[model samples]
Target: MSLLSPKVPALNDPVLVNEWMAVATAADISKPTRVSVLGEDLVVWRSSTGVHAFRDLCIHRGTALSLGKVSDDQLVCPYHGWHFNGEGQCTLIPAQPNMPIPTKAKAFSYPCEEKYGLIWVSLGSPAHGVPEFMEADDQAFHTIICGPYIVNAEAPRVIENFLDVSHLMWVHEGFLGVPEHSVIPEYHVHEREGKLVTDTITVFQPDPDGRGKDVNNDYVYQVLRPLTVQFTKTDDQGSDVFAIMLHTTPLAHRKTMAYAVLTRNYGFELDDKQFSDFQDKIFSQDETILLSQRPEELPLDLAAELHIKSDRLAIAYRKWLRDLGVEVGVA
Candidate 1:
């Protein structure tokens, strides 16, 4: 099979196909924790000030530096007591007598930043800013931060699930999906500053069994390259709801870690506990299905497969990625 075929590529390729693989999560690597990415073992450490990342292997004997300890602002190797600073330069060598440390004795360092309640590392120079939570600053909205969940699927497939509203009816069934509705909502797809933005409006009427009254909901979905999806909802009553779903996949390509925040416009009489419960319920519904998918590599055949008009947004998203030079399987 071809390297870019259904078979997954090695994690150490010169160019990482996706940007989401670079995000650093607390659960993945806390202070003094070591993780591997792009074929290089790395250690992430915290000092009195902030966090730093460097190659985990010591330059002296190739021992894992993460197995060592943090001394003030420097990382001390456990094997030879060599000390390295936040800049990855070896600062001290206990055994060397009156000899200056060689300038070349430095560990490879990567640029990292903490944003949106997560740590992000850059494999290559990122020209764009980190993903932002659109509704985070709105005082009228109450926000809840749910923990991360590991899903066994490619990042693209997982993202497709969020962009695909059609699956809401079948995949979600009784939870939040509308199964009986046969009508497709009107949607608009446009590009904004190199990002794909989609707006869709769907109306729901009262069921004969007395489920709910007539309601119209508008959804806004934006795709920021590499790995970020923003979803905003507005109801007929002008009630606004916003959510940001961030997928940070590991370099291993076997799992994806996601962080989700759900918020609704404040001023409602609902208590904090009630609002928390509501957000949890909706996220739980998505978690259950995402965790069940196989961790297959991307490039799906959507054309040979069955599709409906409701899949318009999902199809557009795939095409957009392809236009950006992403490899996708053709029917």
Candidate 2:
């Protein structure tokens, strides 16, 4: 949170501060918009320079700049009509044009950039660039950006749910898996290039691709960042493949919004809306179960939750969170 707003929870965790989080889609910010990440309210907007992110509060009166408008590539303060340029420096003080603007009289700005149809912001200097999505660069794949599915639970829980295959048989019945074929094959997970990558874990899916065929689906999971994870699902012959990148934004302590970037080799014949709706159904199922989880926050202590053979991925995820010293969304 900003020092100006001491009442808000602090988001100064070293790991989280230096990491970039997706605050909005590139299409969502034509005008000044308010978005929360790690408990700080930021106003994200697009200017001639590029996408800009700054504290939502105007220094003059602490009014939310998001309530204001943009003109001539500058953000206008809603209360005093102060004009701030894309660099976040106060350029014009409507009432006192002759006075010199104080160096401190500026909107608190942060580093921001646009990539993969999303606007990413870092409250502090970024440790590294955004996670990689190889399929996004491949021309053979059709890519679609999905939801910012707002969930009531914290981010880690939502991410862990995405990494979990155990719930497929029950929660996603008939879509991803069925109880009759609930058995999970052994898989391997290890660290590679600062990421947790998993070997193929095969599961039986009743109707995975909407073709209504029962087939064994092989999955490989990777944790690219503390809050970003992905999985690649393929057929036995590796002729067909689907990959999804899951990015979660911590809106607040117990609130998070998840976005998915889906790329598939097949499905070119299907409408993009159909693929979006299909994911909407899958996420909706997880949302229900996630909301019902107790304590809201994910327990960093492994002993707090029971683990089984299939939970190895989740176990590694929790360890990763703990190792990073992330304190925002875990116990």
Candidate 3:
């Protein structure tokens, strides 16, 4: 395909375009919010029916529809007062009241849905639905939405960072790990029904929970989607279980947004704010390192970067993305 070919935009590789990426939290779209996904600008909004996502462009005069107000379940264009409904249909043209609206006056739209308290958008036909967060189904777990953290890095880099366990001892320090037990145990990672799952990864944490005691923690990781990953962590006693589902959206080649769903069986007595705050602090630490990374885009080639035994999961993740032919945020 030529560089000028409209059929193949630089960032619209099918492997990524066909995958669903979380654009915003459900509460973030109370109004017409502009979002960038797969290098395309999008406007996401909520209607009485459900959440809707459309290209941020208004076809009339090439104006941004996000600058317009949404009224009577229609997104009005700020340029010429064209009203578009949730289905991307132009219903009214204020300039010529009696004139029939042209079928081609519609705004380009994409498939979107709300799940796990977040809004997801797909630029092309989705190969699969939103990745499952099974903890949401269990009533015993207390669910907390963590963040929509913006990182100056590629989407795959964000996902790889979430799946990385060796960084805990160095980056998270006393909270998630300790220097005395920094050596990571050899772990197993394999594919199951198209999803990558890792065997139990053990780590010693100075404070695994609010209890403030050191204990060995066990974690099992899963690659839910190209840009979505999850991990379940438990203590040696198996009494406490906490899980996090991380969703990443590639806003552009070097920018990304991440949202996390945290679920725990315990911590019911504790305020949800405490958990949210802790996660915020952890991500803050990660953001600094993520931004300082030399090459912002993740390297898909296995030999591009040296790997240690502890990096097995990250290795599998990169290979999966390479095999999938992801083109938006990698070398």
Candidate 4:
């Protein structure tokens, strides 16, 4: 719940897909739950066989399968008592128990995998495998999954904002940056094989907790898809290496839910609550700024907005989305 009313983005165009997006946390889908993957309505659940994802609409009457319940190891539609198997095959219809289930009674099943406590779903056949974040599996690194922060902004805007380092000084002062060091130092941008990367950016910034002296660290932001961005930080700090991931589950054209996972080489002594609170604070700043952005959607036109040298990566990101023919929330 929020003090300000939330704005749900309107679904006006078809969503595109390339990356395997995290649709739900594994724990959240212990039972059946409705989710949207690249704008496709889905119902994800955990069964004895494993995790399964199906088009939420029932083959019979188009009722949302999510409104149904799990029964006898299968998803049962509430309206008609139709039971579906893990493979989305309608195995039993209480109204017609003696009749054999037809092949056409099956629902569409999508590709799904779980990693880092998240359920990753692909709207299309994925060419790339499920993504891995740094230090998530390392015993030495202390990691914490931070959020499902709901942001009332376009999915692409969330990615562009995460890739944008220049906003730190103005939008995240005192925590992520200070106005005194707002001048962005020269850095290179690289794009190849469907990934846009920043060339080792260094900025004088404060620790996210607003404690101790500031540390100047090098950053690497990787734009893996139209709506996924990640960054790594390294410096003479508590953590030998720090990594952050920003992934958005697009519920609609301009509405999204953001999730962040952080892996740190240090912070073994830090309490999870304290660490999570700090992360919440930092992300709240971004959420406030992003929701207020003009046009509400991300513009694919490079000329839509003025760009500084620091925004070279943002420009490259727009081009990537354009090349991929993404239209949802895109100009």
| lDDT (Cα atoms) of all candidates against the true structure | 0.61, 0.88, 0.85, 0.78
* Top lDDT model: 2
> Candidate 4 — what's its lDDT?
0.78
Q: Enumerate clash totals for all models, in the order shown.
A: 1, 0, 0, 0
Candidate 3 per-residue lDDT over residues 131-177, each given as its tens digit: 99888768988887988888888888888888999999989899899
Indicate the worst ten consecutive residues by lDDT in candidate 2.
1-10
Model 3 segments beyond 4 Å from truth? Answer: 1-10, 209-213
lDDT of predicted model 3? 0.85
Candidate 4 per-residue lDDT over residues 1-331, each given as its tens digit = 2111221223433334545778888888867899886556788987887788887878778888888888788998878999988888889989999998876787677788878778888766577777656567787777777788877888888888888899988888876788999988888788866678888888777875434557887888888766667898887553567788778877865778888888877767767787778888888888888878899888887788887888888888888888887777777
Worst 10 residues of 4 by lDDT: 1-10
Better of 3 and 4 by lDDT: 3
Model 1 lDDT per residue over 131-160, tens place: 666686676766655545556555666677
lDDT of 2 at 278: 84
lDDT of 2 by residue, 45-152 (tens): 889889999888988888999999999899999999999998889999989899998777788888899888899998887879988899877989989899989988
Preferred candidate (TM-score higher): 2 or 4: 2
